[model samples]
Target: MLNRVIEQFRLKVSSIDEVEDSHSSTVYKCNLSNGENVFLKIPFTKLKYQRELEAYEILKGSVPIPEMIDYWSGDEECPGAFLLSELKGNSLSTKAKPTIAFQVGVLQAKMHSIRPPAEKALSGIKNEFPNWSHFVEEQFYSFAEDVRDILDEHLYNKAIETFKRMKQELPSAVGPSFVHMDFRPANIIVDEEKVSGVIDFESVRFGSTEIDFTKLYRDFLSYDDSLYIAYQEGYNSIRPLIDLENVLPFYRFTDAFNSIGWCKRRGIENNALFLKENVVRLKKWLL
Candidate 1:
């Protein structure tokens, strides 16, 4: 089976080493007879496989992502997979400089400016829409479902009510823009101070820019307020600045709650505990 995949690419495989093994997918670094290497991603589910494939096609030449080499949609006998030209750098987290974080924000701004296709465009986790408040409401409910069992009933209800209030206060209309939806340092590829590419497009979609911004804030920028400021400086240089204060708390609650559920489902005790500890941070922003 492995030989067949290599043959399809018209290359004799010298060596194939497994690189990243995760719950949903496995990646391999395939060394060719010519010493060139490519990355293969084999996803456990078809939807995820197709999503990544389509994302690569849509963003090709437009976004700074790895180039797709070839793809095979699996049948009953074989699993689906895609091959990509291996990006030439480590993840952005390797350096963790404020300037790199700022560049990450700059890349995100470029993605947000791109107009997604009208039909067959990827939607948000719930569904994409023009109204940002409705999107926030959907995320609030979806997140509530994920973490209800693990959270204190009273605190959980309070969080929902807080989201409802914030929803009302948000601007009536927000343009539906392309957002990575899962933007994080791990998904950003960098060479020294330059952003070489961004990766992991399975969660790519069109939605409120705030969705991407919120993930950035909760995951990366919060660690250093200066990074947050630096990020905004880069982002606002390209596009109009968002009122993150008005939107941050609402998304923060949903993201933190969703993380708890993800950690619990994966049974990662330390991560779950770490996420649970942030519930206080959520409440402080709300109440």
Candidate 2:
């Protein structure tokens, strides 16, 4: 397959090495014959490929993402692939310092502020929904079905009730702006203690700016007060930061809930700890 991709793209490579961090794609670092480096990514699904391609197109000049050098829209027999210019940096460490966190916040704010071209709005380059609450509700119901057998009856019922209340109480649509749904330290690139780039846009969508903050807060900002403060400072420099006090619980709960379903779909044994953690989180909130 790699040889086929190389032949299809007509790439001249000095060496090719696989990258291990991806969960849903086969990624390789290809050192070009011309002493340049590029990433070769073949996503597991056509949907993933489409989303990433559209995201790169939308974010080309606005965000510090890798350049889309070449692509192949695969047929039924093979999933598609992308050859992207290498962004020269390492993935941001989970335990990133306040300075790096601040830069990430700035970049995220920039992403949230982007509005797609008026024509493309209806063309469906992004995963657009009626509103933020509607998107969340749709996801909750879909994920609930996936985890119905895995979650105890009482817990599942409570979760359904909680989601209903959350839908009623939380704000509906803050902005139908660009959102990187899978924003996290692992997806961010850093160099010399500064955030240089962001990657893995297969989950990109058009939704509330608030939706983008949940994963980052859960994984990074919540760890330290100073980090949160610095992040907010950077975000506010670009635009006013949303008040998360009232909505954090709802978003965080749903994030954990969705993760359980993701684990079930991907494989329970391989993600047992992840599944158990999310279950514990749900119990802490609902039970």
Candidate 3:
């Protein structure tokens, strides 16, 4: 299936180079004979493998996300999906010396401008249309199912109680935006001082701009107030979406709750502790 999909694209591959690895996928940088480079993602599961292909297709032209060169499936039209994307610049994580967080702010603001695809085109992205309260409720239940697996009984129940308290008086929508749920520095790429590419859309969903904005403080700026201030200045310089009171806290709580589940799936216990601490921190933010 992998070879068959590569055949769909006009790539000339003489050497396949392994580039990056995560819990989900193993990526290879394929040096083509045509001088065009592509990233080949082979995921561990068919479900995620297919989702990656779907995410790549829907997100094209919306951001600097790479275009899908080819996709293959075993039973479906594209099986065991193999994605080929033009090799873009260095990821933000690998090149943060000159400050990529500012670029991340601007890039994400642009991504927030994209509208969700039509029902038919939402092949890979999950939950195109959203209800904010229901989304929170679902998160509560998802955490419940994974409670025993992720943490002790006491901490899990405490999180549930915290979520229950904070979820009331939900804010009205400011129009749904195309948001990459994990819009962190690592998922963005930089060339010199500008952002050349935006990668990894698997956590892509249609939601409030807060979903994207929170990545600034939650991921890289957690311990650095100066970086957070600089990032906010850079982003709002391009487009305004700052609210120290409401949206900022919203993003924090969202990440705090979601991280617990994310940590459980990967068996990363440190995240569970982090989430519990943030739950305490988020207490003051709630009105």
Best prediction by TM-score: 2
Candidate 3, residue 111: the lDDT equals 70
Best candidate, lDDT-wise?
2
Model 1 C-alpha lDDT per residue in residues 175-199, reported as the tens digit of each score = 5676777787667788877889888
lDDT for every model?
A: 0.71, 0.84, 0.63
By summed lDDT, which 10 consecutive residues of candidate 1 come out lowest?
121-130
Model 1 ranges off by over 4 Å: 1-24, 77-79, 118-127, 268-274, 277-287
* Candidates ranked, most accurate by TM-score first: 2, 1, 3
In the range 1-287, model 3's lDDT, one tens digit per residue, is 45654565546688887765344566678878877678776666666765677666666776677767666564554436465666456666532542566666666677776666676555556654467667657765776675446555666666667666655644565547777766666666676766787776555677666556676566576556556666666667667864745656655765665665566666666455755675565444442
Q: How many residue pairs clash in each candidate?
A: 0, 0, 6
How does candidate 3 fare on TM-score? 0.75
**Model 2 weakest 10-residue run by lDDT:** 121-130
Residue pairs clashing, model 3: 12-33, 72-78, 72-79, 73-78, 73-79, 74-79
Model 3, position 190: C-alpha lDDT score = 71
Compared with the true structure, what per-residue lDDT tens digits does model 2 show for residues 134-208?
667888889988889789899999888998888688765677788888887778888877787899877778878
Worst 10 residues of 3 by lDDT: 278-287
Ranked by TM-score, the better of candidates 1 and 3 is 1
Comparing 1 with 2 on lDDT, the higher-scoring candidate is: 2
